[model samples]
Each structure stands twice: as structure tokens, then as C-alpha cells.
Target: MDAPTNIQVEVSLGRKKTALLRSLKMPLTLSFPPSPPPTVRDVKRAIQKAFPKFYADRQKLSLPEAPKSLSDDSVLLFDAAGKVELVVGDLGPQISWRTVFIVEYAGPLLIHPLLYHLPTAFYRTEVQHSALQKSIYAMVLVHFIKRELETVFVHRFSHSTMPLFNIFKNSGHYWVLSGLLLAVDAYRPGYSQPVVAGTWRDGPLLQLGWAIWAYAELSNLIVHLNLRSLRPAGTTTRTVPVGYGFSAPFNLSFPNYFFETLAWGAVFLISASPAAALFIAVSFGQMLIWAQKKHRAYKKEFGDKYPRNRKAIVPYII
Candidate 1:
């Protein structure tokens, strides 16, 4: 079979000011035929075809003045026009999504336990510890460990490579928040009290929180397993996930995100730090945005076959 004729593209590799190709005595500007109205991936492929040393997986293509790297690989080259001002560079190094998640989750799992048990020089005085604090710590550890395990065994990433810069960003987010939550709860004055001290009135709220957390964690796991089952090993085929086991019977949207939010809500109920609650709010907001996007994409793909009454991340309310 004859190969498809490639479209001509003029690509500038590496940043305008600091071109990596130029440093390596390679051409900064190269003209290659990719495809008509080439996507970012096409440009990368073109570069790799010409210069096999420059791997597409490590490249981070973006506009010169853009605040962040371009995430949309399907964007047409011609549509960029003046906006192109193409600034290409290595995103340090590429890493798999599984590695990223495992590493990110591991930071919190290890750091939290150390901070709780071992007193630092700054926090030399031991605050009165409570059963609730120990419970919360255990829950946090379990949550992150489960996440790491899921990344390894269950979750399937659509894209294999992530920008190396994301490792730092994600690590900072999880690490800082974990440290802050643990430190604030442990060392902060008047913050180490039990959420419910087995009192007749408020003790039930603590029990309810535990129940909700358990349910949410279990439901989230089931949803992940269902999603993983959709794409069998050695295949890229996508199938609509039917509601089953912990999923709402009539809903075809992101039920996992709903359960995830509920789990965090339960965590917030048990937490003494306002920061923890704030973090949950922010995480839920971000999850909702992604869930809504997923919902819309499903509707677009499935048309009338998609469920009509299901909300994005919530059952009846979004």
C-alpha cells in the first residue's frame, strides 16, 4: 500500500530563546511534511521522523507567551496562525501516569505517619493525642495506599506520558496539603480534640462519618474496577459502562467522582482543621468540572443512548 502524502510544516523546536536543538548543533527550524492541518502530535512525529534522537514523548510544545504547555494535541497547526509562536522544548523527562500517581500518593502516606509519630525540632512539645486523630491518620494512610495500589493494578490511563513538570506540581500539592493537615491537627493549639468524644449527642455523627467513608471508598473501588473491565488487556476498544455494584442503576455518568467527593466530605466531618474542609471543597470543585466534561463527551458520543436524567457528579443535584 502507498503511504499517505505528508503535509509540509515549518516547525521551530525548543523555546525561542533557548532552543535545545541549536545547542545540540541540530537545525532549530526544520521543514517537514506531516499531514494537512497537522496536529501537535503530527508535528512531533515529523520531528522524530527527521531527527530520531528527539523523541516526541519528551517534547512540550506551546506558544511562546503561553502560561502553560498546550494540552490539546488535536489542535490544527494552521489554526494557530500568529498564536502559534511555537515554543518547543523538553518537559525535562517523561513519566508514566502510573508512576506519577504512585509517587504522589506515596509522599503523603509516608510523610503523614512520620509527622504524627515523630516530633520535629519546631514542634517539640507533644500535644494531647486523641483516638479520633489516630483514626483520621489511619484513614488518610489507607486512602493514599489504596490510590497507589489502584494506579498500579486497576486504573488505565488513556495517555501514557505526562510532562515531567507535573511530577513536581502534583507532588507539591499532595505533600504540602498532607503535611499541613497533619501538622495543624497535631501541633496547633486547641486542635487535637476528638471530633466526637463518645458523647450521647455528637458521637453518632462520628459513627455516621465512618460509615459514609467506608461506603464511599468501597463504591469508588467498584467503579474503578468496572471502568478497568471496559477495556480488556491488549485492546483499546471502549464500551459504555453499565451501572452495577455501587453505581446508581439509572446513571451512566461519573459515579466514581460522586463517591470520591462523599469520601472527602466524611473526612472533613472528622477533621478538626478548617484547611482540610477547604481542601475538600477545592478538590470537589475540580472533580465536578472534569465530571461535567466527561458527561458532555459521553452525551456527544452516545447521543440518545446516553442517560438523559443523570447529573454529572451528583445524583439529582449538580
Candidate 2:
């Protein structure tokens, strides 16, 4: 089959019509020819070529009618053009991915604790506290705090800037879910019952749940640290992560996600809240999707060197 020819594209930068026409001597319209249709990145490059003053990475190309900026670098120009009018602008401000993660996690860590102290209409009386309830609070707090710390100290993000709106979206997701899980578990009438109440609060089961939670949390931290050590600071390098200790046999593509699910599953088991279990299921589902994407990416990037035996998020099931 014959290869596809490049499609011609005309791009305009910035919003001020009068200012752009008056201040700029060069022609605003520029044509781009890219094989298989150009991406947003190609459009930005064309803009940069026509007008040397504009930075490609800093530019936000969009359809004028759209409410949000066109941020996807991989989107074909032809696909976007059919949807709306193409327009380009300078991205006003940017924040790092690490900062976004920290902020998102911090919201839940801070807001979840307030449910216990704050006078909310949800509880007719002050929510009665128990040793188990207090333990749950401590674990939840530590979980988020650990994530925040890891984002700052351990995780190295390749893409520096995320969509500015994502910070708010992500923060809202974590904050709302954390509150929902904690509130449901803490204030529910069943939680107020003593440990002597049947098999639900059996001593051995509670101990087992705690053990699973601790192991998963610690294992996840180790996996993250090991992954971090693979790539040195101030560099972008890909390395195959070799499992060690408890992780040695699995050869899972994303053991971190697996451990994360286990940690939340442990919490769900301990809390015995259907809502909490549902949240864990939703989270695991999302993580599985991402893990599969990562697995494909690794295969594409490393080819034969990448472990073919590795499953996405599970040892053998997935």
C-alpha cells in the first residue's frame, strides 16, 4: 500500500486579533505537511517555525469554540479540525506533576481527619470513637502522607507540567472518596458495636487484616524506592525492575499497583464497609487499565528485552 501524504494545516497563535495583526509583521497563517496527518505537537512546531518568538512546549493549541485547551500531543490534526475551529494560545501558567500529586494527596490527608472533629449534620451526635476507629484514622492519614512524601522524594516524573485543571479534579476525587470511606466506616452504627460482636469483629481476622495492610504498605514503598534507584536524579532512563524478596516470583508489570490494591483491600476487610470495598474495586479497575497501558508501553520500548511473562497487575490471573 502507498504511504499517506501530509495534510496541509493553517495555525494561528494567541487570542488578541488586533494586537496579533498590528504588532506582528510576519503572516499569522502557516501551512504544515506531515505524513499520516500531523499531531498537536506538529502544529506547534509549524507555529514555532513560522514565528520564532513562540515556544512550542509553552503553546496551547485549541479549537476556538472549545471550553478547554487542546493538550493531547498525540491527537491527529485532521480529527481535531472536524470537531472545532483550531486556535492556539500561550499556556498562562504551569505546575509540575509532582506538585499536582502532592496537592491532590494532601487534600484527603487533611480533610478526612476533620470528619471526626467537625460538627456535621450527618451525625446526630458526636461520632463515638473506638480504638479500632482511631487506628483506621491513623492508617488513612499515614497512607496519604506516605504517597505525598513519595511523590516529593522518590517518584521522578518524565512529563513536567500536567493540565492545571487536573490538580483540582484529582484533589476533588481523592478528598471526596477519602471522606466518603472514612465517614461511612466511622459514623455507621455497626462500628460503634464492641469487638465481642460475632465473627465480624473476630480478633484473629482483625489481626490478619492489620498484617496485610502493613505488609502491602511496606512492600509498595520498597517497590517505589527500587524503581526510583533505577533512574538517577536529573536524568531520564528506563530500566527493567527485577523483583527481590517477596516480589521475586511474580514478575508482574506493575507490582506497585497490586500492592496498593492489597493495602486498600486490607482496609476494606477491616472496616467491613460495602462502600469501602466498592471504592477499592473502582480503584483497582482504574489501576489495572493504567498497568496494562504501561505493560504495552514497556514492550514497545524495550522489545525482546522486556519480560514477556509479566502480567499487568496480577501475578498470573491478569
Candidate 3:
């Protein structure tokens, strides 16, 4: 009948049938200030401290009666009539999203040049890499370098961590599909030779591709910088970014994705390789999915304040 002194959260494995009863019987009680109720993250941390095996990333906490996991910042409500039970599901091994990006990008950063210089390692006879191949190599290197720098310094991730197994899956996508496959095809004998064989090393298409690639690369950087400006360093806070460069119209929710797609398209145009084509196709598809989700979040978060005309990853015709 009197005001509650402190809330108690009983931890249990959500999937078990006897979880609720076991939790109530043997509860892992955590004390918190009544002024600010304990958040989901606070509860998870408490559970992790009590059970070392259940780290924050591995813990999916929810009310015993609720079907959905609680958001990290969601405050736990105390019940006067009954026990407060927190269900935790182990999400398996996990790693930081930043680590995942660095590891995956490292694949292409190292593999591209290795395959270019030491073709025999990949079971290909060495042919002198043409100026075009060198040029394409430079572009890909620059692209990945920018990605690494952004991951390390510029971009802020919304999600703190991801499943550990994703490192292999992501690395394979970057290493095998984007790096090795593209390099093998692009650096193959006679694949990148000049149109005039020797004298015209830098063909018109090569020049045009370089121009497009450079423009797209710089545009992508601008968009990234703008996005970074929305969120301060060391925080995941976000705001609607001011338009610049290709995103001047603010028509695309993910203008950076668009620019990267264009940049890869330029790489394909220059190399004229099937691997580059395939990589861009796969990359675009993934980016499109991410963009759609982000777009929906933006609309939901900002409501009518968010632009109604904005597309997900394209200018006007996503």
C-alpha cells in the first residue's frame, strides 16, 4: 500500500517455460534511484554483472509477459502487486560494429593490391598491369581508404555492436566479391590494355571514368561530412543534414549511398569487368535496403517535419 522503496528485476532465460517461476524464486535484485527508473541497458548491465556470461550484447531483456525486447533507454516500471521479471535471451557472440567495418574494409585494402602485383598467387600468369589497371586500382584504394577513415574518425554508428559471425560474412563480401573478384577480372591479361595498345594509354573512356569517379568520390565525402556534422563525435545523436553537392535537393535519404553507387558504376565503366558490375549490383541492393530502413526511421522520428518528397537512395526515382 505504501510507496515502493526500490524495484527488483528478476532475470531469467526468456525461452524456458519455468523462467517466470524460477526468476521470482531466485531473483537477481538490482538497486536504482527511484527518481530515474533503471533503463533497459542498466538492467542488462546488472544482469551481466550478476551473470558474467551474459554480456550486454548477448542479452535481450524484456518483460516476462511482453513479446518484444525493450529498447536500451526504456525505463523499467515497478509493479506494486507483482514481481518485476526481466527476460534475457542470449544473442550469441558479438563484436563492435566499428571493428566489423575496419576488418571487412581491410580485406579489399590488402587484397586488391596483392592480387594486382602478385597475380600468380591467384593462379594467374603475370601480365604487366596497364595504366588503366593502375588507375582503377588507385580509385578502389582511395574509396576503401575513405571508408576506413570515415569508420575511424568521421561516421558515427547507431548500433554499438553486431553479431560476431558477421565479421566473416562481411569480410567475405568485401574480400571475395568486391576485392578478389574485381581484381582478378580487371587485372587479367589484356583486360585493361589501352585502346591504341601503347601510345594512347589514357583513353577517352578512362579519362571520363576518372572524372566521374573523382566527382562521385568527392561528392560522397561531402555527404558524409554533412552527415557527420549532424552528429557530434563520440555520440550517436543525429539530425537532418543540410544539403550540399549531389544532395543539394535533399531528395535522397541516403545521398552517400547514391554517390558510392555512382562511384562504383564509374569503376565498372573504366574497367568494363563483369566482377565490377556484379559488385556494384550487390552493393546497390544492400545499400537500398539500408536506405529504405533509414528513410522510414527518419519519417517516423521527425514526422511531418521530414520531407515528404525524399526518396530512400535515389534522387527522384528510387
Candidate 4:
């Protein structure tokens, strides 16, 4: 058979930056320097190159790589003219339901440990990569749901006397997004197959907001800072898989990862039991507290570029 040409990709930076990457009435083909680039190998070869250490990992590798990633997996498609253009990771091959699981597991391995475990890797590696993990998490979480868990266990809208816990509102948004993806897959077996939902337009539209929020957090200040190292100026070069600030002792750290894990658990828990949903709210509280501090710091720094409309951890209110 001839080579398949149906491979598609959608690339965007964000709304304000959309024009930078989006194409109108055309597939999003990219150019290097001035000319269109060359074709490349498939996914298996790409994995071997980027992760020479993980030859075994590549043996039954289920994750997907961009079509072009196989060209030289170590280096993305950069033009010989020396002007960098884009990346396979940025405009990778389309993600599928099975591949989404691999992406989700990567979250716990790549994000949660770093978020709440290691000190050395957190500070040493760029926080942007760490923060991007959230984007990936949100992307993956958009794939699961339980009905009763969504409605019964947690309250979507209400006043929280605790500003720290108020961010559960955002969790609700994420949970809702997860629900939509679940609904889609639950009803439609394959992306090509048809499914039924009775006038269910509301869920997806609301979900877009949550996805945007997830993207926003993916680019936020906390995500920008790598917290892998916890040494003073003169302290020895000690490393831990993860570390928390002295103020944030190990006991305190669980609550953060717990918040993350529970956020996911809440999603799965929404239909099973309220206990998980309650934990979801609790985790929301911890995450909000974490974000509120930085939101305040930025407000103090910008003094003016900051908008009064800004809310720290949640979307609408501060």
C-alpha cells in the first residue's frame, strides 16, 4: 500500500498567540527556514534514539511520537539554514485513547514526584518542562468520568470561607472536562464511529473553559519554578528524588501530591463515593493555598499590569 497521508495535527500557543501557529482552511504544515522539510521514520525508531537508556522501554512502547520524530529522534526537525522552527513534541502525531493512558502514567512519573518528591531534579530541570506536565495531565485527565461522582460527591458552586479550598471550582471544571472525554469514548468506540448524546452540547462548551484554565496553569508562575533542590548557598550538593521547603515538611508535602492524586481520584470517585469527592475538595484547598501565595506575589510585583479581575487559584474571583 502507499504511504498514508491522513495524519493530522493541530498546533496553537493560546488565544493571544493563536495567529502565530494556526492555519486557516489548510492542514497545519510547517516549513523550516524557507522550504518544506523531508519525510521521516515511524514511532519505534524515534523512541530508541531519544531514550538510549530505555531500550527495554522501547521494546513494547505504547506511547505515540510525531510522524517526523523518527527522522533522528534525538533532534527534532530543525532546518539546515540554522533557523529553528518547531518540534515534534509541539506538533506531534494525534493522540489516541490508548496512547492517552501512557500520557497519563507519564504524569505521575514526570510530574507528581517532582511536584512533591524530589528537590534536586525540580530545581535542576527547567520548571517550564515541569509546568508543561500540568498541560499534559489536563490533556490526559480529559479522558475519564463517573456521573454520580460528578454530581453527588462534590458541590460545584458555593462560597468557601476558606480561600485555600475555594479552588475546587477549578477542579469542578477539570472534572467536567474529564467527564466529556469519558462520555465521548463511552459512547463512541472509535474516533471514526458515531455515538449518541441527547442534546448534550452544554458539557463540551463548558469543558473548553476548563481546558483553557488547565493551559493557563500549565504556563503559570508555580509551574515555572522547579523545586527539586532545597540547599542553602553553602550547603553540600545533596539531592533527593524530591524535597519540600523546610516550612513545608514531608507531612505537608503529601497534602500537595494528595491534592494532585485526589484531584484525579475525585474524577474517578465522583460516581463511586463521596469520600473521594471530599478528598477532591480537600486537595483543592491545598492547591489553592499554594497558588494563592504566588498570585499575591505577582500582584505585588506588577502593581499595575495585574488586573483587579485576577483571582489567585480559581478563575473568576481573587
Candidate 5:
């Protein structure tokens, strides 16, 4: 039998209506091509076309019975009568993931330099920071600047947007720990200074730490580029990252996380600040959880094709 040319979709608002607008009293009737099997995104686009005021990003489309909003890629299900019902929830204010990432990274990028230069802001007095303190401060600036650049040019998110309020939560995390906390600790009086006062002998060790930090930062960027390469432009395809990117001698499920932790660890080594250590510990815990989730997702998606030897967030260890 030939495929149906069009499927009529009945669209209405969900129970949890947005306060931004009153509930859409009249259900909308929209026609979609059946050959392509329209997705939630297509349905939302159709709705947007009909009601120009309702943009796709602010619309959360779902099935009539399902309380959860449908993903943009979800295929529409039509009954035998060639009719499908859809409910849209208003997301109210929404922000693109790209904007969220930029905002989140910008917090640290801006705060770090300010706290470092304004000694009185954090230290409460005019006090000289050790040479190592100055070096680590520079590293902090470089690291966040690189992150901002990557967020703008390199990274592609699977989801285009998120709720508006998440920007504050994410920004606070980076701004507080990695930026304000570490910078204050590093710039504090006498940090990284030798008790014996013998010409600040950590110069040699600081040089070594800087080298390691550079390597880790570069490796992290490579991993991000590799991950980006796995998914082509304008698509959200997940493929097994083999060889240098996600597999091989590293055998770490999330080498990016490992390299990021290593970079932060190098900062701690350079500054010898408790705040830096605390940041590393807290971030490692979070990265480990995310790595474990990603590892599980890989195994679940690829099954036996996934290497059993791969460990999450760590090399050769859990």
C-alpha cells in the first residue's frame, strides 16, 4: 500500500501552562507529511508557523498522555485514523546551550583576573604574591579563555537550548570554586613561599608543573575536537570514538575529564593552595559521575562493541 501523503495533528497546550500566556483554548489543526514521519521539532515548527508569537524554543511539545515533554527528534505516532494528538507546554524563557556555555565560562574568565589583580578585594591588605602565584593566575586566565573560545567555535551541543535558570546555577559553580576561591587562595600573602625564604626555590618545580599543565590543556582540546569530529555539523549522531580520541592506550572512557583534572592538579602543584585542591576534589567527583554515566551509555549503545577494558574518568582504575 502507498504511504499516506499527509497526517493531521491536533495540537493543544499541556496542563502546566506558562504564566507568560493564557492556555491556548482552541486546539490547532496542522498537516504534516507522513512520508518523512514528522518529529516533535517539525510539529513545533508547524505550530510556530501557525502562531507566529510562539517560537520553537519556547514550546515544549509532548504527547497528550505523557507528562514529560517529547524530545525534538521523537517521531510522531498516529492512530489508525491518521490523526495524532500533541500537547505543548510553554517553556517560558529559554536560553540556547551555546549561550549558557558562554555565560558559564565567562564567569570564571572574568572573575579570575579581577580577584588576582585586586588584592584588597580578597586579601584585605596590600600584600605581595609569590612568583608562583602570578604564574598560576596567568594559567587560570589562559585556561578559561581557551574554554570560552572552544565554546564559541569548536563545541556542538546535542540539545540546542536549556531552561533559562540553569545559567545561574552553572555559572555559580565555575565562578565560585575555579575562579574566586582558587584565585583568592593563590594571591593570598606568602602563598607558595618557602618558610626558609631561600630565593623561592620552587621555580624549577613550577616550570615542570607549567609544562605538564600545557600538555594536559592541549590534550583536552584534542579530545574535544575529536569528539566534535565524531558528530558532523547539523546532526546529533553518536558514534564509537575509536583509536586516539576515546579509545586505545588511554583506555579511559572520558580522557577529556582526565586531562582536565590533570590540568587543575597542575595548578594546585604550581600554587600549593588548599582552595585549588578543594576545587580539584569537588570537580573530580562531579566528572567521575558524568564519566560513569557516559561510559554506561556507550556500553548500552554499542554493547559488546564497546571495549570491556575501558574505565570511567581514570586510567586503569575506577
Candidate 6:
């Protein structure tokens, strides 16, 4: 079979012009106990109130061009009446880094509180194709927690009684990993006659340790990023880290906001992994030392330009 390509589109009917303007209209009838029939004006007002932006959509109505997709999936579009209109190939990226960022970073903060400490999966060959994939799941959970910290600094305070609801405030900014999964599925879609089953093929015990460590690193990310953003007031001296001009404060830099992201990401992979603990621990431990070294280098070079006593990873250690 020939490989699939990467450009797709989903076509739908343009927004309604008025309450009376429903496409592929279906009529529903019911007997009411002497209630007044609803008028068209009331319907119009309700529609406008619900979707203010769609009210003025005057774009030309036609099917977009079908292009090749990055992933090997057929495209399907639906209208209000549930009919496929235009089916294009990949308009969206086959693999998006932003979605990877959120799933890998911000995921852990939420996961840790909910799912005890250790990772959910064991060394199951059936559930996961390889230990490497389980590591990936843990890794995504780590990033979710790390990135979620932004909820505090970026979002202004609200006195909402529902904390769960607040998490949705800037949710549009999230990277939906499901898209990647769907794209991948499209590329080589699965199901053996629609059968789904998996099992473990024996493994080590330290996976739990790695899982715990993964979540801990996630916890650290949230604190660090939020802390990193809120620098001490009235201290404007260096553009980059104190000594280094543009290079990061640390050797391996991602976003300046999420300092310890890689460290946690490593721990997630190493968790429940057949890898040596000393190796992973040493890696995480060294990251701390490196961060402190960079911080110290910055402080010594710029003096008052940098804050006096800012610990890198641990509270009062470095």
C-alpha cells in the first residue's frame, strides 16, 4: 500500500444567519399542555446570545481543496445535519511540539494528586509495546505538571468556589496529545478485528521508584517555574543570567520559565525502566549542581544584579 501524506481540512456549514436559518432542517413536534408556541424572534435572540461570533460569518461556502496528509488518515467533515462535506488531507501538523510540551509537562501536577505516587502501568509487554513506551507515558505526565504552573502567574486571581472550574480558564493554551495519538493511529491504525488486549512480560521493581521520582520532579517544576517568574521586585540588572549574555542560566536550557523540566523528564523515563538508578539519580543530582554553579557564576559576576540567596533546586542547600 502507498504511504499517506499531510494536508487535511474539515468543512462545515457557515454560521446561521438567523434563528430561522437551519441547514438540512429536521422538524420536531410534541404536544404541550396549552403552552404558547415559541415565536421566531425568541429563537433568533437565543441563537445570537449563544454564539455571538458565528452571527456575522459571511464567508463563501464551498469545500476546501483536499491535500496530502502528514498522517495516513482519511479526512471527514460534518455539517449541523451530520453529513460529511469536504475531506482534505493534513492541514494540521502530523507531530506538534506544543502538544508534547503540555502533555509531558503540565500533566504530572494533575496526575500526582489523583493517582497516588507510582506510575499506573507495570512492565507489561501487552499493555505497552516496550518499556520505552511506558517511560513515554510517565514522561508526558511529568510535562503536564511542569507546564501547569503557569496557571498561577498568567491567570489573575478569582474568588471562584470551584477550583476545578478555574483550571479551564486558559485551557485553550493546552497541547492535546490525543491529536498526535489520532494522527499516529491514522498512520497505521490498529485493532485486530477490533480486539484490544495487553499484558506484562516480566520486569524490575525500581519502576515504581522512577514513577515516584517522576512525579516529584513534576512537583518541583511547578514550584520552580512559578517561582522563577516572580523575581524579586526592583532588581533589573542583567538580560540573561548574570555572567552569560544570552546562554541560559543552566547548560541545558528549555524555556527560562521551566528550569528543571529536563531533569524531571529524565526521572520519568528512568522510572520502572531497566536503567540503573545510580545513573538516573546521578543525572538528576548533577542537574542541581550545574544549576547552582550557573547561579553562583551569575551572582559572582554581576553581584547585586542577581539576587543574593536563590536556591537552584533544593530549598536552602545550594
| Index of the highest-lDDT prediction | 5
**Over the full model, what C-alpha lDDT does candidate 6 score relative to the true structure?**
0.35
Model 4: per-residue Cα lDDT at residue 86:
25
CA lDDT, every model vs. true structure: 0.68, 0.70, 0.80, 0.33, 0.81, 0.35
Per-prediction TM-score to the true structure, in the order listed: 0.73, 0.72, 0.89, 0.22, 0.89, 0.27
Model 4 scores a TM of 0.22
What lDDT tens digits, residue by residue, belong to model 3 across residues 1-318?
875677767776666443323433334666766557778889888777876765787777888888687888787777883347777776678899999999999988998888788877774566666878888889989999999999998878777899999999999999998888988777777654543255444578889999999999999999888887888776667676557733446478888998899999998886678899999999999999998998899989988988788888888888
For candidate 4, the per-residue lDDT at 265 reads 48
Question: Which consecutive 10 residues in model 1 have the weakest lDDT in total?
Answer: 76-85
For candidate 1, write residues 58-168 as lDDT tens digits: 666776566466753556454323223466676546788778888888887777777677644446756555556666777788888889889988988777779777898
Best by TM-score: 3
TM-score for predicted model 5 compared with the true structure = 0.89
Count the clashes in each prediction: 1, 0, 0, 15, 0, 36
lDDT of 3 at 124: 55
Shift of residue 234 alpha carbon in model 4, Å: 21
RMSD of 5: 2.6
Candidate 2, backbone clash total: 0
Model 4 root-mean-square deviation: 24.1
Distance from true location, Cα of 289 in model 2, Å: 1.3
lDDT of 5 by residue, 34-102 (tens): 878888889889877877777898888877777787888899888766789887778877789989888
**Candidate 3: worst 10 consecutive residues by lDDT?**
17-26
Backbone clashes in candidate 4 total: 15
Q: Clash pairs of candidate 1?
A: 14-88
